[model samples]
Target: MLHFLPAPLRGLIGATLLALNTLACCVPLFSVTLLKICLPFPAAQRLCRWLMDFIHEAWISCNKVWMNLLGNTQWQVEGLQGLDYQHSYLVTSNHQSWVDILVLQYLLNRRVRPLKFFLKQELIWVPVIGLCWWALGFPFMKRYSKAYLAKHPEKKGKDLQTTRRTCAKFSQTSVGIFNFLEGTRHTPAKHAAQQSPFKHLLKPKAGGIAFVLDAMGEQLHSIVNVTIHYPQGNPGFWDILSGNVDEVVVRFKELPIPAEFIGRNYDQDEAYRLQFQQWVNQLWLEKDAELSELKQRFPGH
Candidate 1:
């Protein structure tokens, strides 16, 4: 480990290494994406996705190398058994910090199907990396605010419709679709501002995961419920680069989606919507307790 180096220097080295890795991987990613579009055959498209996944994993593997060389952050993870790379999973987790994304990708890269996150529609236009995300089949979501929806009543359920369309394409292939249940990162200020009930989490948003299940519930093998706790406390992306992160605890459980939930219309059915909200609330309640326990049990080494 390069722990002896000054942290700012390590951070600069880490950033440069990761940027180079991403640029290296994006070239082949775009090439295969173009090949897939030109061919237009199912067989050819499948081949392109496979090739892209290989490239995607390689990029992540390179990041792992840089992470190992930069610092000595300990990873404590469990409940990864029985996961199949060939099966689709709805992976849900609590939001803490930007570091959560790195921890998830670092630990769960090849253990499950490649994770495709739901991105904001505007992100598609970002630049080189935006196209790389598109090439990897990340679903870009355009969300409408309540005020906008109220002004244009005709646009109701549009987000759900878009999700349904995107998920339909995923049905043909195995993927790990990830969503952060807490829409935003949790912080003491945010918790107090929102008057959140849970001690260690923000309010769990039901609409996001409900929409995912409504669209592709039957195709998904199970819900990969994940909890990530940083015993050193939540840290930003810079903390990772600066070698400040000491330890991370991750726990996962595979929960079966109820048969009745398959193909349910969340927007149209009021009763189902209430039931789903209750279910999500219960999950957040448990996760909050888990975080409380991890804090007590897993102090930093």
Candidate 2:
């Protein structure tokens, strides 16, 4: 183990290895992606997807090696039972740090289908990683502000159209669709600015997930509600890379999607929209309480 190395050296080595891993995997991944694109047949697309998923999993496994070599962080995880890889899930989490991505990637890799986050439409242009995301079938959303929507009256109801059109691509495969309910990482400054109701979380944005359910409600098997905690305080990506993070805790619960939510239009139906937001609020309440319990369990958080 290189855990004995200095933090700077560990971080440097980790970053280098991660870059190399991504570059190496992207080579084959891009090739398969090209093949998938050039040939639009269902069988060809399926083959390419399988190849890409394997490459992605390999990339994640390489990260595991480097992390194990660098840090001895303790892990406390629960509620990971009865997960099926063949099933699709709408995964939601409390966002805190960039490391949360790696944690989830590490924790649920093969336990469920590989995760594909709902990304912004602009992210599809983000160099090599962007292409990879596109190849992997991550849905890109074109979100419009209320004012913008009002200015362009024609754009109204198009959000649902975009969501449904993008989500239609997922119907053929079982992939984990992830959304950070808070929409951004939580921070003390942000908490104070927003006057957050929860001590630890920012306000949960209900619209994104609501749109997701409205589109893929039939395809998704269930909602996988995940709560991640950093007992040593939320670490920056660099902190994790440098082996400064001492311990991590994460909880996973498979929540059944409410039957009423299925086949419901979140934007068109006012009643469904209100009821869905309430459901999300209650879920957030439980997640906040769990964070509190975890904080107490670890002490000095």
Best model number under TM-score: 1
Report lDDT (CA) for all predictions. 0.88, 0.88
Error of 1 at 44 (Å): 0.3
Q: In candidate 1, what are the lDDT values of residues 1-301, reduced to their tens digit?
A: 8989999999999999988999999888888988998999989988988898899999988988988898898888889998888889999999999888888899889988779888889999997889888888888888888999899989898788888888888878888999998888988999999899999999988887799998889889999999999987789899887777888899999999988888888899999999999989999899999989988889755
lDDT of 2 at 193: 98
Q: What is the C-alpha RMSD of each candidate to the true structure, in Å?
A: 1.2, 1.4
162-235: candidate 2 lDDT, tens digit per residue: 77887888788888889999988899999999999998899999988888888889888999999998988889
Task: Look at candidate 1 and tell me the lDDT of residue 70.
Answer: 88
